[model samples]
Target: MQGLIISALIAIGVIVLLGMTIRIVPQRNVYVVERLGKYRTSLEAGMHILMPFIDKVAYKHSLKEIVRDVPRQSCITKDNIEVSIDGVMYLQVIDPKSASYGVDDYVMAAQQLAQTTLRSVIGKIDLDKTFEERSEINMEVVQAVDEAAQPWGVKVLRYEVADINLPASIKDAMEKQVRAERERRAVVAESEGDRQAAINRSEGDRQAAINRSEGEKQEMINISEGEKMKQINEAEGRARQIELIAQATATGLREVATAVKEDGGEEAVSLRIAEQYVSAFEKLAKESTTLLLPSNLSDVGGTVAGLQKVLKTIDRTQP
Candidate 1:
């Protein structure tokens, strides 16, 4: 009975020792081992054997990337404006041993460092630039924190400013400024439209005036041309009438000359001259209401002789 109990106790002790010696670490995780309260080695993701009661896992660190939120804090800009800012930081533990021993708390240190760097970056620029240069500020924070975290086995990949809070007064002022600028632009646009409309109206008036002047000029030209044509036609008609009158007078004179050469022409001409002389005396007596007599009223033959001589001279001169 005593020997059976001793074998059973040995088997139970062996099982407890094996259970204490063997360790299995998960993937992407590192275990920092310490021997007798001093850091010995860092165990990777695999099965590890350690002497029982001698080696212990001091710290466990994940190699995976982590995201940490930086607490919101108030900062003053170069333009003397107070603004609240907050961000997120991407970090990874590169060395488990250093991460465990180099710093009291690397995560808290990184967060505090990021806050300080962000404040510093914000203080260097004005309020307007703070809103516009957020990426630059984030990059600067990452650079500053990453440099400071080297000994702590923390790698800061990047930083991003998540939110920026501005005062209500400042927001209202900005809105007013934008509204005023828009109103000024609208006024300028309306003025430009009015100016363009005035120019168009003036141009139209000028064109219309020109067209009216052209029409007037054309009308004057037509009138003048018509007057010239009328004058020419009148002159031509006058000339044609004068020509017809001259031709009728010439034909009458020719017929009289031909009749004078016909039978008994001398007797007929002498009688006609005597009759014209008597008719002239009668007309003078009636118009003057006085007695008018020839120097020799009985010398009718002498007057006839004078008229025949005048007629003979005319016939010789006419062709």
Candidate 2:
């Protein structure tokens, strides 16, 4: 009976020891087990058994993705401008054994490396580009840190730059510059509009002036043509009057010549010639001009006597 009880107690002790040695880790979790202070194999999730006294679980890390934020750090840019930068890193443990033994603190190491990498990257770019090229800088940082951390069994999944802080004075200067640029553009646009309007107005005025001038010129031309036509008509009328008077005078001269030629004696022709001479002398006397008589009083007296006889005959034939 004593031996059976001792054996039963030993069995119970062995079962308890076995129970303590078996570990059931959850999914996505890894246990870095060590044997006698030396690194053993990493224990994966679900039903991992180890030597209770010889082997110990050193560190447990989740295989799931973890996020850590890099604190804001002051950095100088390529333009010698100072700025503050912050970022976040997504990481996962690829190898729990190496993550346990490779570095003292993988989280601290990754954060420091991220900060330094961020500073170095920011230093190569201007302050304006630091914010604009944040994605590119994130890619560069992830690549660099991922490469460096490969031996440590850490995988960097993604990196993101959260914010970039500029100095208040720099922000103020940028705002002023933007405002000035807008004002300059507005003024230029306004001036261009005004100039175009003025040009249009001037063009309209020029056309109007041209039209007015053309109208005035045409009016003056019409008036000048009318005056010319009036003067031509007056001159034509005077010419016609002179032509009619000349025709009448020519007819009267023909009648006088016919009458003189039809006279039957030289005495009648002499009388007619004396009457024409007397009429011309009477017209000359009206103008008060002196005439010298010929030195033949007998011939003049004979002409007067012939004219008197022709007058007496013409009076007897009158109806």
Best-fitting candidate, measured by TM-score? 1
Per-residue lDDT tens digits for candidate 1, residues 1-319, read 9999999999999998898798899999999999999999999999999988999888999999989999999999999999999999999999899999999999999999999999999999999898798889988999999999999999999899999998999889888999999999999999999999999999999999999999999999999999999999999999999999999988876676666678887678889889999999988888896786878889998899888787667666678
Q: Which of the numbered candidates is closest to the native, going by highest lDDT?
A: 1
The lDDT of each candidate is: 0.92, 0.86
Residue 36's lDDT within candidate 2 is: 96
C-alpha TM-scores of all predictions:
0.61, 0.57
RMSD of 1: 7.2
Error of 1 at 11 (Å): 6.6
> Alpha-carbon error at 214 in model 1, in Å?
8.7
Which regions of candidate 2 are displaced past 4 Å?
A: 1-19, 188-319
Please write out the lDDT profile of model 2 over residues 1-319, one tens digit for every residue.
Answer: 9999999999999998987699888999998888999988887879988898898888999999999999999999999999888889999999888888899989889999999988899889987788678789999999999999998899999999998888999999989999999999999999999999999999999999999999999999999999999999999999999999999987775565556546564467676677787787778778876766567634766767766567557545544
Clashing pairs in 2: none
